[model samples]
Target: MEEEKILAIDYLATTPVTAKDKRLKARRDPWMSRVLRYTLEGWPTTVDNELLPYWRRHEELSVREVCVLWCDRVIIPRVERPAIIAELHFGHPGMTKMKAVARSYLWWPGMDKNLEGTVRACERCQQRVKAPPRALLHPQLLPKRLWSRIHVDYAGSFMGRMFLVTVDAFSKWLDVYATQSATTEVTSEKRKTSFAIHGIPERLVSDNGTCFTSSEFRTFCESQGIIHTKSTPYHPSSNRLAERAVQTFKDGSRKLETRSLNETLQTFC
Candidate 1:
């Protein structure tokens, strides 16, 4: 018959040791070793009277055989503490679920408190917590004049070409320009051409796309004496003026199935 492997604490205390074994010992070794030694020998009179019942049940068994400390429940050995907890709490489960799983298995002193702390400290669990209440919307004042505030955005590769879309906040005037690329340089040049025709707007608004948020784009707006404003990150309604225009353009383009790209642009113009 195969001999039962001794508990970790018992093996460490009785076996011949090397310098490496001493260095690799856990911080709780002293306390665990003493507990194992006391368990192997008969319980002393000074031992906690509260544990008398547990000792009576387990006294007949060797230290390796009765690794569990059954005072409250079957308490796991110190060496297996972290691994057992991790297995019970895998997938960063919520506190209630973790507690339920832990209670179903071998336990330790302060197990509930330690589980709480572990779950609380988990970065993934913290991130998955419900977000705080969203603040109320504070809408921007309506523009008093045409071209005073302009919203810009990009739409489509309808015919293998993207369009730079601009919409005036007050007039609701829409301008769509087919572009070879959506790079900052290309977009800035397109905007410059439009600015020359319509005059530069007091405020230019766009989404947080790379073309709009680029340093080059900001410099271009600065040079033109235009205030550049970006809509709230991931909030499309803030730039609804440009979004509506893009939708309108796409809806109109879809109907002109027989028309070529140039013909479609001419019809829209």
Candidate 2:
């Protein structure tokens, strides 16, 4: 409706064509050109309110013109469709905005089938309805040796008690501590016990949780000669191994049933 209203053309007249020339020779398609020109002229009025900063800046381009030029000329002809789909799913600002941005580029494939299913199967969209593409930050480095690089994170408790896990970077060994309260004092005591058993690590990596960020924890790390490292506030990849470990655990769990269903059932029983 907005596209039709903004383009000032009957939707039926603007048949979707997967032609690079559509955008390239946009000025030549008399009917389409008039609609695109008018849309571009009225972009400031129609899209100014709905779009973000980047999209807003392209107000000089009509809806059809922008779609044709940006989609066909820039995206379809040059960029791979799968990559474009991924970028649409992950790299864009928001889901709604991404779809809106994608609509401009979406065209009949140049001798391909319907892309609706492919577009819908995007994982990011499946996980988050309309989340914006978060800018990726640089990976942080550990300031020490292999096992000395300790990463502690809490997980599960989805069905049972939460487990605080300390992972060794080298051996991929995990030391899990089941805890009732994730208090600063409790966490400190657990860390001390862990250090006593496994010896002090050169560096410790953790989320910016209250327990991890507490003065007591910092003092404890300082006292133990262990450097405390806080992960990027919300980014998990700061200690990327944690993600890998979780995936490994999930994969192994999935395999357990398949590799030996009888053994798995026996073990559970």
Candidate 3:
């Protein structure tokens, strides 16, 4: 019989505890025990809800000596997850970067949420959150009153979140929303939120992004009694207020220190 080769996760090379310590901890872990047994023997027909996450991915799981692995990534034990999270977050790399690095090396149940929570709870990480590169600020046609004419644009994936940036042309008051999507639905929803506070604008200006040009968005604007205008195709600068609003958001976010992305955006304004 050919020997089964073991895979190594580069991130585990610098584990807080040694491999022997990890093996010892793994031996004491009930979840790891089940995973090890299932991989070495055969997966059971069914599992309780707590273990269902593991059962779903059993086919990709393997063992290296006594350590549990999900494909090439280490399945970190529950006891060591805090230390592991600390090590992963050592440099105060924000939630997004930490998650990306963790995916390359190790995993745990709720790892994504865990990583996000860690950074949110960490003061150093929150203080050092950076924004996208600064862009040139352009002047645009001013309007007569606040909320009469507004410029809108998308900014991100900045600090692991997309943002809908709205700038009132008359007042230059900024509103930023941390969003998971840049879809037409999300865009309109954000606009509605702004409208609830400041009332709907008479004219809305944006670049030629599909989120703005889509029929769905056009209908949304028409329904709201808004005059929607798009910048010349391939000439985003024509919608100078929104373009500069995005730049202002990026520039403002860099100097911000807040508990969450949404708070950072709110505080910047």
Record all residue pairs in model 1 with backbone atoms less than 3 Å apart, i.e. clashing: none
lDDT digits (tens) for residues 1-269 of candidate 3: 01222223344325465568877888788887778888899988998787888898899988776766777777888988988887777545577778888887787889998998898887767765654444544455557677998889899878888889888888878888889989999999988988998898999989878899999999999999999878785764367777777876775576454446765654545
Off by over 4 Å in 1: 1-141, 233-237
Report the lDDT tens digits of candidate 1 across residue range 1-269.
01222222221213332224432342245544445567666666665654444455555434433343443334554555676666555545457777876565335556788888887888655644553533443445568898999999998977788999898888778888999989999999999999989998999999889999999999999999999989995764478778777866775566555777776665555
| Rank list by lDDT | 3, 1, 2
TM-score of 3: 0.47
lDDT of 2 at 211: 88
lDDT of each: 0.67, 0.53, 0.77
In model 1, the worst 10-residue window by lDDT is 1-10
Candidate 2 per-residue lDDT over residues 1-269, each given as its tens digit: 35433432222123333345446555554434444555455543443322332244343333533343333323232333454554443321234555555565443233122234544565533544453544443444433455688888765542244556677876667766667767788788888888888888887888787988989888988988988878794765366665454433333334343434334223222
Which pairs clash (backbone N, Cα, C closer than 3 Å) in model 3?
A: none
Instruction: Report per-prediction Cα RMSD to one decimal.
Output: 23.0, 16.7, 16.1
Please tell me which predicted candidate would have the highest lDDT against the true structure.
Answer: 3
Per-candidate TM-score against the hidden true structure: 0.46, 0.39, 0.47
Model 2 lDDT, residue 128, Cα? 44
Please give the TM-score that candidate 1 achieves against the real structure: 0.46
lDDT of 3: 0.77
